[model samples]
Target: MIIALTATTQLGGIAWLIGRPFRQSLLVSLASYAVLSISAIWVAPAFGRTPLSCVPEKGGAHAGIIFCVTNRHYVTPELKSALNDIVDDLNTSFPGIQLGVLDASFPFLNDFPMLPHLSHNDGRKADLAFFYKDSDGRPLPGGTLRSPIGYFAYETGRSACPATRFDLHWDLNWLQRVWSKHELDIDRTSKLIEAATANPRIRKVFLEPHLQKRLDVNHPKVRFQGCYAARHDDHIHLQL
Candidate 1:
């Protein structure tokens, strides 16, 4: 009887040992699956592979001011510095003006279909927009401003009431006038571009046609960095 009891106990212990590994394996598999599910929900959207959960909504003091779509990884150091310098000059020139940076680089694949070949592809371009305001602290009378750069589809015929047309224009006239008159702002932007070009790392500086016209061809102080690359209509694209 004692021998029989010993054999039964040994068999029971063997079965318990065998089951422990299966239980542990099941727990591990569950944990791995949970982790993968959470990652797919959050991390995948940042790379343009999935739809974004957090769509941008209007926040600031203004209601119609829509937030820009951007990913932090798309901005390079050089581009960021250039943008900051521009903002500083703008703030100094037009104090208390509400200026904001728009699309630096859209994370969505088809976000800006019209500007498919934009410099944002390589993280070297940014779209900027200014807030419209009246003499009072209220929003202007017009509808929200469309994107400064990009193609839009519109109907050619007047009968097509629902149809719209593409209109492309950059409001740089004020900026041109301001830069022309403000010596300090001009010097700042010039120096910024100079530093950008001085680096042996940079290969070219693309300027808009209007900007090229404004720059003196034989200005001894300014360097003729590079010829226009045809693609830069709204913002200058610097190549490094």
Candidate 2:
């Protein structure tokens, strides 16, 4: 329980430890986790981090519920501002579309290495799910993520990197078969990338090479994250 809770929510292991001696351990642990998580949201800003919205805002980007529940949605205030600005730009071009965020930095630490993502240790980094469209090319409703947690539903394409093991670049072939039949919205996704790269505060954006070619994104800051990192084909990684 400690390992599972710690891996998902950084604070949950501590809560479980605090509640373990109680008669109703599960309930105590859950309540402890809730209090800690809510407190983190308020306390994090003191350490120069702020949380993205857990729930979707009108015409704005928000992290998926999975990210929120796992306490992975904290980011620097400037990065949060840049995200809102990017959404504003997107709304100007394609009104009413909202972006879905995946994993992000945990609250209350610098360089604490958010697992699976090496660089997200700092609060400046975050992942954004690609906008998707139905088979007919119409935009899906806002907040509709291709995968439940907004990761691992890849847009199949050719890659230069060879297959390997013992790294973060996972090819979850079995899981892909079960995801919804949604197509990547090239126009909106491309625009989102453009907005991110164009933002002065956003230092870099990681995307797969094939995706860059397919989207026709030529921004200098949009670079490949290298094969050692988790595949960027599933979600766009942006950092300050």
Best candidate according to TM-score: 2
TM-score of 2: 0.96
- Across 89-125, the per-residue lDDT of candidate 2 in tens digits comes to 8999887777788888889778775676778887899
Number of the predicted model whose lDDT against the real structure is largest: 2
What is the TM-score (0 to 1) of candidate 1?
0.34
Worst 10 residues of 1 by lDDT: 151-160
Candidate 2 residue pairs in clash (backbone atoms < 3 Å):
none
- Give stretches of model 2 more than 4 Å off: none
Taking every candidate in turn, the Cα RMSD to the unseen true structure, in Å, is 19.7, 1.2
**Global lDDT scores for all candidate models:** 0.35, 0.87
lDDT of 1 by residue, 2-86 (tens): 2332122212222333345675854654454345434444553564433212232222111122222223123445655554454
TM-score of each: 0.34, 0.96
